[model samples]
Target: MGGDHGLAVTIPAAVNLLRTHSHVFVHLVGQQVAIEQSLSRYRNLDPTRFAVVHANDVVTMDDPPAQALRGKKDSSMRVAINLVKEGVAQACVSAGNTGALMAIARFVLKTLPGIDRPAIATAMPTMHHGMSTVLDLGANVDCTAEHLLQFASMGSALVSALQGKMNPAVGLLNIGEEIIKGNDTVKQAAELLRQSNLNFYGNVEGNDIYKGTVDVVVCDGFVGNIALKASEGVAQLMSGTIRDEFQRSWFSRLCAVLAYPILRRVKRRLDHRRYNGASLLGLRGVVIKSHGSADAFAFECALVRAHDAVQNGLLEKITQAMVPLSAEADAA
Candidate 1:
């Protein structure tokens, strides 16, 4: 809650959530006025449940990494990461400064063992049915074949954890179902994926994306981000169309009422914004990136995701499985 945008909406909404969930701890990072304002709004909050830290820094979108880190030591983003590092906080969630957030997370949280680069793994609604998780979603646009494999392993493990299964049946996001297709990186990644112990479902295409044809789709950040954004845009267009159709004349309005409950359910199920936060896998701690336009509800959902990731001990499981697998491969 530190950026130029005031915390008027976020702070109150967070406060109410704290009130409902007293077990949860809320930490505020911002200027004295903003922090104090939030605390005062939740004055009756249990002293132990809610805490405030006056941060001297706020990273803007335009600020380069070097500038954000060197220029703003007291910035809220930096301070938040520091708290995570020092064990004062389990994890820090931010809605501001994507580049800055990645920089701070890398700086403070550190990468998980054997992971050279962390990737953004997020759940997306599938057109075929249910939902699927995609990884390397803009965290790394360019990656080595090995890096893509890591994303596959990481995404597979995460999806399994979420879906309650030993293996969620992974798929490599590629230009074609044929293993031989795609550029050098994906081709090599496909070879490695085929060798992995995890459930590797070979390659999938953009058209196969929402088909719910695979549990996890792995791709480089560049393509993955484009796919994610395009899917979101399409979902939004569909929502608009449905709303327009429902709002027509009296008869249509009556039909809208008849279908209101089901349509609302469908809209909620399909809303991309609801699952906006993408977990930065391969990081020591759970760090989520939500949309810049995210509202308080989205922020709250992100918080829940962070909580779930930690509770699931996702990093621990992935690392436990990967380190040994790497060893076995080396020995072979």
Candidate 2:
């Protein structure tokens, strides 16, 4: 109910997931009346598989993180997360305010044993016809070298679990590929990564992201968020230019008809909906943050992501990976 389109998009997505994934059960945490009204549209919904828990309030997009935490005790976002904390649900996915979700999640679920702060990790389509997991996407703005190393370790574990890669190569994002190029934090983090058991690939530039130079890329939240937004902007600009040029003239329309199949393939490749969910790694419970403006298809992608994370034992994998690292840290 907290998303941009509210139950209008989320309910349909939930219904679709229930229909397609027979192994999955959904607990809709929001106003029961609205949820029932939306579910009424789909006559074939299974009552046993889909249930709605009542939430009195909603954490709006504009609500400050602290205010949302203090005031909205019975909000949908908080209740959904509570389900995870209580082991009633394996994971929680929200398209609500990011700050509110993070604040409430950290408060309720808490961080993992060895993690200082949770980092946001998302899959980005790469030129190699694969995806790269980039972390610290607007979770922690300022990070120490230790935090960066933790992000790398968490990211490596995530990719291994979700992407089925053993010892996936990890890269530290920097201005240049040279070891001496980055700031103190990045340099220090690089040293830590190299000394660890991970498959560290040294420093990689911004262009390396699209090149798929590594399976995972690590950076501070401030830089990672900027890079993500800039890439999205460029994709939007290119899509718009293609649409405008195709509709400019009769000849262009004819060209568009002839090139329709190729354009469709390109569109599918770059569809943001395909990569809708951003996992908040380093949390004890799985929490996926869908884009606030996401459509039903995009929201469904987030649900699928949460489902996969639970089935793959993402939490267990991260915990096991961190045990040795924690011991090493203590020894040092």
Candidate 3:
């Protein structure tokens, strides 16, 4: 009831997830009649696998976060999060308004004990056919040195829990690899990371992100969001250029046909749909945000992320990782 395609995308994605994950149960939190109607389209689905939890309203894409938080308490987004808070659901996933989702989640679940704010963390594809987790991807545009340190801790926990790396290296994103290259806030954050228990790898440039220089890259939301969008732009441009070049002549068209198999594998390797979910880290409960324009496959990917986080004890891992930081603060 919230994303660009509403029931069309989400209902199919939920059905697909139930088919694959035997332990999963879905609560379709929207208008009960409409949700049931969509669920009826799919055949041979187990009735006990999911149930419709009625929601009276929806938070639109253009609604202000405050309005969604206060005025639309009964909206689908809010109701779903409420389920998480009530212990009825282990996690909440939404392809709805980002600001509204973040605001409502922070307000309802609150941040974890030692976390000042909740940062959005997602696994970014790297050159080595692996992934590096990056954080604060539009959650907090301005951050203090301490906030950056918090991001590093949460990101390390995410990578560890998901990828099975006990000590994931953390890198501070900067203009250059030099220690003195960044502004005061970043330099201060670097100093903090060095003294902490995390496996800090010092400064890394933008290009090093794809180079797999570290398992985690920490930055404020302003810079992180810009980097994310720029990378997306580059990927789209490269793909478009290759397609245009291959369509210019009969000889090129024949070459494209011959190279189709290799190109398909390459495309699958870097498919953005596989990495669709972004976790709202630092929240007391698990909540995932999906891209609003996602198709069924992409939405299913987001559901997979939410499922993995729960199965892997992501919340407990984050809490354990933050203990040293909390102790340091107490001593200071």
Q: RMSD in angstroms, all models?
A: 2.5, 0.8, 1.0
lDDT of 2 by residue, 2-49 (tens): 679999889989999998899898999999998988888888677889
Which candidate do you rate higher for TM-score, 1 or 2? 2
Report the C-alpha lDDT of model 3 over 27-79, residue by residue, as the tens digit. Answer: 99999999988988889999898989999999999999999999998999999
Q: Which stretches of candidate 2 lie over 4 Å from their true place?
A: none
Report the lDDT of model 2 for residue 39: 86
Task: Judge candidate 1 against the unseen true structure and give its global Cα lDDT, from 0 to 1.
Answer: 0.78
Distance from true location, Cα of 257 in model 2, Å: 2.0
| Candidate 2 whole-model C-alpha lDDT, 0 to 1 | 0.93
Comparing 1 with 3 on lDDT, the higher-scoring candidate is 3
Deviation in angstroms for 130 in model 3? 0.7
Instruction: Write model 1 residue lDDT over 133-192, tens digit each, in one string.
Output: 888888887899889888888887787666666888788888778767999988998888
Query: lDDT per model, in order?
Result: 0.78, 0.93, 0.94
Q: TM-score ranking from best to worst?
A: 2, 3, 1
TM-score for candidate 2: 0.98
Q: Which of the numbered candidates is closest to the native, going by highest lDDT?
A: 3
How far is 309's C-alpha from truth in model 2 (Å)? 0.4
Model 3 — which ten-residue stretch has the worst lDDT? 122-131
Candidate 1 or 3, higher TM-score? 3
